[model samples]
Target: MGKLVFLSGAGLSAPSGLSTFRDNDGLWEQYDLDIVCNYQTWIKNFNLVHEFYNKRRLELRKVTPNKMHEKIAEISKRFEVINFTQNVDDLLERAGCENVIHLHGKLLELHCTNCNDITKLNLNDDLEFKFENCKKCQSKLIKPSVVFFGEQAPFYTDLYSTFYNLNEDDLVVIIGTSGAVININYLLRFAKSKNILINLEKNKYINEALFSHIIYKSCDECIDELEQIIQEWNS
Candidate 1:
């Protein structure tokens, strides 16, 4: 009867063949984040940004959920699980997890700049960058739904609310986040609960002191240990 809040990032989906922005040959290397993923210059490089995300959408369709994602989905069936992910991919949904909240928005969706109506992109065919009209308002200012660096995340309010409402006995599990975009320490300040951190590498940005338990391993590598810890906590 306990709540488990999973604060997952790109690492959660990395095992499924998706690349993180920080990866050596990752998207960030191929394209400058300031030019491609920054909201301030989004309009200036509209076609470039669209092309980048369009390729990502196509790549997402080719990969399947890994063991870690499937395990998390299985755990959700037995516990009160809430997912807050910074990733734009739908791998968690594809792995059968329900009601996963995307903190950074999603890739397979386009929002009208003028009307702000979100439309699901068709991945059945090859995606290309084009100024598509909005389905609802018929405005021609559509862009990828993912939140850029300079834009405000619409779901941050929900994230703060979720943390503030938590009980001290609840568990907060942070996975694969480097605290680059979202400050881990600041977010955890609202949660009066035990915390866990799982990451593949050490990040200077993250304060290791915050977590009661820390695992420096990939999500897939530590799934068994992670499940055991969660089970013990629930018990």
Candidate 2:
């Protein structure tokens, strides 16, 4: 049997006191989307881009992993779980899940715009309120490693390799994304594996008939139900 591949999104972390990107009165309402999230603004005002993610980094200090995150970690004990998450947060890692992959990138890591060397920022380190400088080299534009509005996801090479090697018996579960940014076809072509979706609502971009199951509920609740099934199957 193949491993269980989980594709998670913002909803997976929302219960842990983080907000999803597109919800009403969410991040878009608080910040200027064009300035904080777009590429045009990054070039015009790199400092603003830095500030935007810097604030988000600080916010992570207040949150903790919730039941769903812990449960997903527990799943790893029973099966090989490749958690492919679009969220920038480290909630899954904090929840003790091994083998978690961030598709969009991670907020806890920074990259030098000039050298492109990645630095894993320490959550406990009291970084000055200003943008941090690169440690390896004297590079100026050290920014969060996240995939921004115009940037292609940097992990596609690894993702493609994983999908190419996916077995037909592998279970693919997509949760929380509304089909906004990621090209669903990119994942679908290689997912000859069994497929399912767990979301607050049906994803408009996906053909409903394609999935083996569709569960409309909070990801936390759906995962609880799925866990029961898995436990029974194992027993």
Candidate 3:
């Protein structure tokens, strides 16, 4: 079986009207990242964090999967594809992609801060929300079931090992992520070690040498090309 892995970042979801964290013109109504995304801020003011993520969830509810998402799903049918996304959005799953690993977390899942108990919840189109309490112990819920800033990323060791041990012929595709994020950079290196790095970027970053093929284009265009490439490869 041909192995194809995709590592996607925020840009993958931009076509669906999701704003990236790097948007400079205050696309998110001037929401401060540190206030809602950092661990210290979450600890100091859980309500603020909750409200922010809740708003994001509401936005997610309204947005549907875009063309790139559908193309990835179609590509998966021809190859043994694994998607590892830094985005919390569930757009990939909505597009019918299987075996997705959310490196950051999922918007539809919530965990208890005190108990680490995770539960999937149905999201509504509302700016404010609350989730059901933990079954074992009643506690407040948090979004993404993921580690925030200043916290160690969960399943890191396993994620690292999996990336490193892929077969030599495995094709690793990096899409939209910046080269600066340590975890993603490490994974890029791992793909390089296996001699397979196919990266797609709209703009150049520092670690340009890691990719075997670098396509500078929007995710929509890159994914369209990827689908054609996969079809040819499978044939």
Cα RMSD (angstroms) for every candidate in the order listed: 1.8, 2.3, 3.0
Better of 1 and 3 by TM-score: 1
The digit string of per-residue lDDT tens for model 3 on 97-171 reads: 987888777777777777877767565433344555667677654445655787677756656776887775676
Per-candidate TM-score against the hidden true structure: 0.92, 0.88, 0.84
Reference-based lDDT, each prediction: 0.85, 0.76, 0.69
Model 1 ranges with Cα > 4 A deviation: 122-126
Arrange candidates by lDDT, descending.
Answer: 1, 2, 3
> How do the candidates rank by TM-score, highest first?
1, 2, 3
Best candidate per lDDT, number?
A: 1
Q: How well is each residue in 119-231 modelled by candidate 2, as lDDT tens digits?
A: 77777995323655677787777767888788788677776777778776777777777767765556677567777777788766866665777888887777667775555
Give the least accurate 10-residue stretch of model 1, judged by summed lDDT. 121-130
What local lDDT score does residue 112 receive in model 3, on the 0 to 100 scale?
73
Report the number of the highest-TM-score candidate.
Answer: 1
Q: At residue 99, what lDDT does model 1 achieve?
A: 96
